[model samples]
Target: MTTVYAAASMSLDGYVSGPAEAGFDQLFDWYGNGDVEVTTADPALTMRLREPSAQVFRQLLQETGALVVGRKTFDLTDGWGGRHPIGCPVVVLTHQVPEGWPRPDAPFTFVTDGIEPAVATARQLAGDRLVGVSGGSIARQCLDAELLDEIRIDLVPVLLGGGTPFFDHLRTAPVVLDGPSPVIEGDRVTHLRYRVRR
Candidate 1:
């Protein structure tokens, strides 16, 4: 069976990105600085290590064998940098397939509007491998479409008063937690894994 997983970093106040997704945007300028700690606790992490929580969860996402993203993120990512935090099939959900976006050498296809369509495309592309949902709007679309099988959130400690949020301005049904597992990475961040029940 094909499984869909959505992973995100949320804050203590339930804001994943912040006003218009600013928290994540703030990270774009992280400048590989090891001094700024982005996690629940101010832990130690060198440039050698990205976000500990992201590293661990990215490993899981790699298992997906395929990934889907929205055009905003894809275009921002230089036409979706190859395979993401890992090298997996990536399908960008967009109406416009811009030229000269510096696409990765790897296989990166484009899907039209909607998350299910993207998931369907990924499933067809993945064959028997798992599918990953990475990005804000795409994830929300998945949730709205009820196509996501699971969601893993790594609650970070950073505080961004405003930005794009993971779960915002969407009407979602009741969801329960599978459980909580803790992961500590080189004193950088502590990741709490939660199984999101559909």
Candidate 2:
């Protein structure tokens, strides 16, 4: 069976970016310790600390067979350079399809019907592998539909005073989670894995 999940870098205040923050670079700088460019740090030391998480991230990319995202995220990322970063099929849930989208032999599938169909198509493409759902709106839709199986959040220590949040407009009752307590803490971030209890 394929498992569907969402993973993202979030701040202490639960915002993914600051208001009017362009491109969310600050929210995602922890991925490569890119902010270190402005601070004093040995290149070798920085790579040493970042290597472990980078390896794990690569493994996840290898395991993902398909990705699902909302139209907003698709537009924000410019459609991942016309190929998904995971190198798998990408299903976009949107009200209107792009003019030049679904190009010949492209890895994208635009679904305007609804979220359920979009996720279903991703599951079919994923097979026994993992289906990655991203963007706050799409993930929240999955949560509401009870289609998500796990949530992997990289809790960054930064405090984005205001901006888009990780979870917004969710109406479902509290969902139970089963995983190791305390989560896995790294140098600059904490990795949390939670299995969604149905």
Candidate 3:
């Protein structure tokens, strides 16, 4: 079965990014803090991760066939230079498609309807592989819509008092999760996975 999951590297204070879109170095330190090299679809970007984190990262890259992200994230990364590091098709949820987009060469689908439609498009693209939902707002929407199957967090030991949160503005309160089942400890981060209990 294909799984729809939300994953992000967050600080101890629950921030995915610090004030003014800063602190990514601290939040994503695990990606380059180790000696193991992992290359992505983008030849220019490669991750040097610890053994444990490398294993988890490899699995995510292999399993995720498509990703759903918000317009904010899409703009922030400049559409990931037209090719996301994961090397998968991307579904961008927005009210309007960005200018000069829907390009024939890009494997990106702009869904203006809503998160549900964006996720549905990603599901079709993913086939039997996993559908990854990114960005705090998008994840919250998926949780509220009951479309998320799992949550994975790379918890970094840092205190970013104010920044972007991995989970926020959830309409449904007290959402229960099953387990952080198989916790994998890495150099400066702990990889936690939980099943969203419906």
Candidate 4:
């Protein structure tokens, strides 16, 4: 079955990004800086800690056929460098499409209607692969609508007192998380996976 999931590297305080912070690059430094530390002298244990997490990320980027993002996120990041890092079709939700935005034939699809329509378009484009919900507001909409299946949160140790939160303005009755299984844990960060019970 096709799944819709949201994945992001977040701070311990639950913010994805903040005005004080530079950008996502600073928040998600663990990916490039080898900030993930395994506490074993054995090379096998170290590889064990790293390999599965790497595989999961590899699969996420390759298997996700479509993505969804919020308008503010789009504008803030400049459409993710004109092409999403996931290398898939991206559905951007906004009230009005930007004037100089890329055409429909481009990698991005600006959806003005609503989140439902944007998700539907992404689902159709995804086919058998997964539909990835990105950006805090966009993901929150999916979660509020009970449309998200899974959530992968990479918890960075930094504390940003104020910023763009990972979960805010949600109107759902106490959603229970299934498993906060440690996908990856280290000195700098920890990646946890949870199933959203419908």
Backbone clashes in model 3, listed as residue pairs? none
lDDT of candidate 2 over 1-198, digit per residue (tens): 689998888888887767886436655665666232221112233332365466556667678989999998888878877766567889999999988888886789999998899999999988888999998889889999999998888888888788888888888958777883437666577778888899
Worst 10 contiguous positions by lDDT, candidate 2: 34-43
lDDT, residue 100, model 2: 88
Those runs of model 3 whose alpha carbons end farther than 4 Å from true positions after fitting are none
Query: In model 3, which range of ten residues has the least summed lDDT?
Result: 164-173
- Number of the candidate with higher lDDT, 1 or 4: 4
Per-model CA lDDT versus the true structure: 0.65, 0.78, 0.94, 0.78
Task: Give per-residue CA lDDT, model 4, range 130-182, as digits (tens).
Answer: 99998888888999887899998988888777888888888895778899865
Q: Tens digits of per-residue lDDT for model 1 on 1-198? A: 688877766665566567754666434232243444333111332233355544664457457778888888776867534545445678888887767533556678787666777899898887778888877788778877878777766666577766667776566856565766554442324455656676
Off by over 4 Å in 2: 34-49, 180-182
- Top candidate by TM-score: 3
List residue ranges in candidate 4 displaced over 4 A. 22-26, 35-53
- What does candidate 3's lDDT look like per residue over 151-194, in tens digits? 99999999999988888888997999999987999998999999
Stretches of model 1 off by over 4 angstroms after superposition = 18-47, 50-58, 80-83, 100-104, 181-188
Candidate number with the higher lDDT (3 or 4)? 3
What is the alpha-carbon lDDT for the whole of candidate 4? 0.78
User: What does the lDDT read for residue 77 in candidate 3?
Assistant: 92
The residue pairs in collision within model 4 are none
